[model samples]
Target: MNIGVIGYSGDKNLEPVKSLKNICFEIGKLIAENGDTLLTGGRDGIMDFVCESAYKNNANVVGILPWDEEGNKYLNTTIKTGLDFSMRSFVLLKSVDIVISVGGQVGTALEILGAYAYKKPIILMRGTGGWTDTVTKTLIEDKYLDNRKMVELYQAYNIEELSQHINNLRGDVNL
Candidate 1:
């Protein structure tokens, strides 16, 4: 499966950087260990952090870049769309089977909406700050993003929960 992880791609000196890094790292490692392909916006912040972790753990890391600029070195494959940020986001989400949102601002929110519009399952990691922490509040019944019910949004407070969600989505039912 191809899993896309999106979040902040700005200043890395924020107060939550350390915690976010740890969370992103675990997410990356989990994706690698599960032998799933890892996809991202292919910029900095959450994207770079998670890609690096997954790369080191032997996962197939792909970065969907907005333009001709190079992606993080950790990416094994890079797709340059030559499109602007917003346009590139849709391309990225459209290629993924599922998406995981960490903490992010407008860009992350846009990606989340794109995933929803594509009807791809989204796993928002809570407490990582930014949209990951606030998007749920805006959801209808904390599940559906809106009246469309395009897709049901799922939340993961920790790595374990994230793993479970991925497993469930893959239909790896233990029962």
Candidate 2:
């Protein structure tokens, strides 16, 4: 499966959280070990950490860029989408089976909303800060995004929970 990870890009003078970085590494490793491909925005911050770790573990890391520029070295394939940031995000989400948000600001929130609109499953890593915690703890009715329940939203407070969620999805089950 192609799992998409969206989070703080650290491009707006915001610093990357220490714990979130560790979570990104572990998440990448887990995805690779599960024989899944990792997809990201193809830039720095969370994207770099996850892609590097996944690539080191012999996973196929695909980076979707907002521009026609080169991506990080760890990516096995770099897709220069030529679209702007917001447009690139929709493309990324549409191409993935599942979406995971680490710590996010405006950009990540947009991706999550897009995923919901696309009816793609979403897993939010809680306690990492930003929208991951906000969206998981609030704005969700039970595990649904809205009255329509566009898609089931999941929260993973730790790596174990994240792994279990992935496993359940692997079996074509919804949590």
Candidate 3:
């Protein structure tokens, strides 16, 4: 399974929100342990955390880069889209079977919308704040977006629940 993780790029200092970073790292570790691939925007913040953790665990990591820039060192396969962020975002969303939204701003909102449009299953890690928190509060009710009942949206408050959700989807009966 190719799981895409979307979130903020943060500042140049890469001062991360400790809790969110830890959750992302744990998610990455779980993904790797489950023998799944990790996809990201190929930038910083939550994306960096997940990709790095996955790489450390010897999992395949793909990065859909926005431009022809140097890709993240942890990426196993880096696709230089040569397109702007918006276009690159589409590629990232299209390449993943599932999306995990940690904490994000406007860009993360766009990725979530893209996942909805693509009919991809999404797991919103609640308590991560930013658009994820907002979406969990209002946009999604009963695991479906308003007027879009076909969309699959799951909420995971922690790493264990997130792993269970993904494992269940993968038909891991033991889960």
Candidate 4:
């Protein structure tokens, strides 16, 4: 199985950085131990940290980059396969069996939409940043994900809880 990690960008803060790094390591370790591959956008911030951790853990890590040229090298080094991010969203969605959305921005929102369309399992890590706080509102207030035949939404605030919730959703095709 492949677990994709989605997060925000251009965000720089000591606590957020520390949290992202820790979550990256934990997610990498979990994926390695569980014999699952790790996937991400492979950019700076959370994507970079997680990709680095996955590489360190010797797990198969794929980076779906948003660029086609020599770009975002800081995080691209750890990626096993680097695909054009915008053009390869379909491949990324198909590559991952489950998606763990840590934090988000516009790109992350689009990732969520792609995952939803593909009928994949998604775990939302709340309080991280970006659209995390707006997920419940988006689904309930806007009915974005309501009454869907497939697609599971699990909200968590930390890496441990997020991991557990993902494990719990291993059996359910959708939430």
Candidate 5:
């Protein structure tokens, strides 16, 4: 299955929150070990960190780029949407079976909303800060978003829990 990771691309320095970056790395490693493909925005922050770990672990990495720009050396496959950020985000969310949100800003929130609109399952890594934390606290109630029974929002406090949740979703107990 392809899992899309959406989060902060960081500032001009391209520096991600240290602790959140570590969590994203572990999540990527787990995804690879479980024989899953990794998808991302193909920029910096959580996207770069997770893609790097997934690549090292020999997972297929697909980057949904907003433009035809180069410099995404980590991605095994690149899909240049040739669209603006918002439209590109829709493609990213639509291409994946599941979506995972790390710490992020407006972009991440848009991705999450896109996932919901697509009716794709989403797992929010709590305590990672940014909009992810806010979503965990506000937007969802009783694990459902906006009383939308068709889509359920899941929260994982750590990598282990996140792994278990993914495994459960796949009906694999061995992971």
Candidate 6:
């Protein structure tokens, strides 16, 4: 299985949360141990860290760049596959049986939305920025992630719990 890891890039003045990066690495390791490939944005911050960790553990890494070759010069050479973002999201989510949203910005949130729209299994790492906190919590408070449609919405505070949830998911018609 390929688990798509999503998070914000710590570029220039922006910075990703420390706890988020740690969780991403831990989750990356678990994906490796399970012999599953990992997919990410293919740059620095969460993407670089997650892909590097997974690579160290001998897991295949796929990088979906938000831009073309011009935008990927900063991307790590560790990626096994680097593709354009517009075409990549569909391919990335389809290739993965599940998706884990780490620390993110609007971009990561879009990935989550795509995964959900496709009926793919999704795990949101709580406490990260973007839709991770705002959207789901509101939905949970308003009673959205608790019904039959929620068979695909999963949330975890840490990497271990996320992996456990992935291992336990079953009977879903998609992903």
Candidate 4 per-residue lDDT over residues 1-175, each given as its tens digit: 7788887654434555556667667777777677777777666678667766777777777766664533243332333344555546667777788888767777777888888888887788777777755676868533247676466677777778876886787766432
Q: Which TM-score value belongs to model 3?
A: 0.91
Model 3 clash pairs are none
Candidate 1 global lDDT: 0.88
User: Per-residue alpha-carbon lDDT of model 6 for 24-82, expressed as tens digits?
Assistant: 67877898898877777676777766776788888877776554432223233333335
Q: Which portions of model 3 show Cα errors greater than 4 Å?
A: 12-19, 172-175
**Per-prediction TM-score, please?**
0.94, 0.93, 0.91, 0.78, 0.91, 0.78
Give the candidates in order of lDDT, highest first. 1, 2, 3, 5, 4, 6
Write candidate 1's Cα lDDT for 100-160 as tens digits.
9998889989988889988989999998999888888899988888898888889999999
By TM-score, the best candidate is 1
lDDT of 3: 0.83
Top-lDDT structure, candidate number: 1
Our model 2 lands, by Cα RMSD against the true structure, at 2.5
Off by over 4 Å in 2: 11-14, 173-175
> What is the Cα root-mean-square deviation between model 3 and the actual structure?
2.8
Error of 1 at 145 (Å): 0.9
lDDT at 119 for candidate 1?
90
User: lDDT values of the candidates?
Assistant: 0.88, 0.86, 0.83, 0.69, 0.81, 0.68
Tens-digit lDDT track of model 5 for 72-124:
56799988888888889999887888888987889888888889888888898
lDDT of 3 by residue, 34-144 (tens): 899899988777777888899999999999998796666889999999998888999998888888998788989998888889888889998888887788766546587
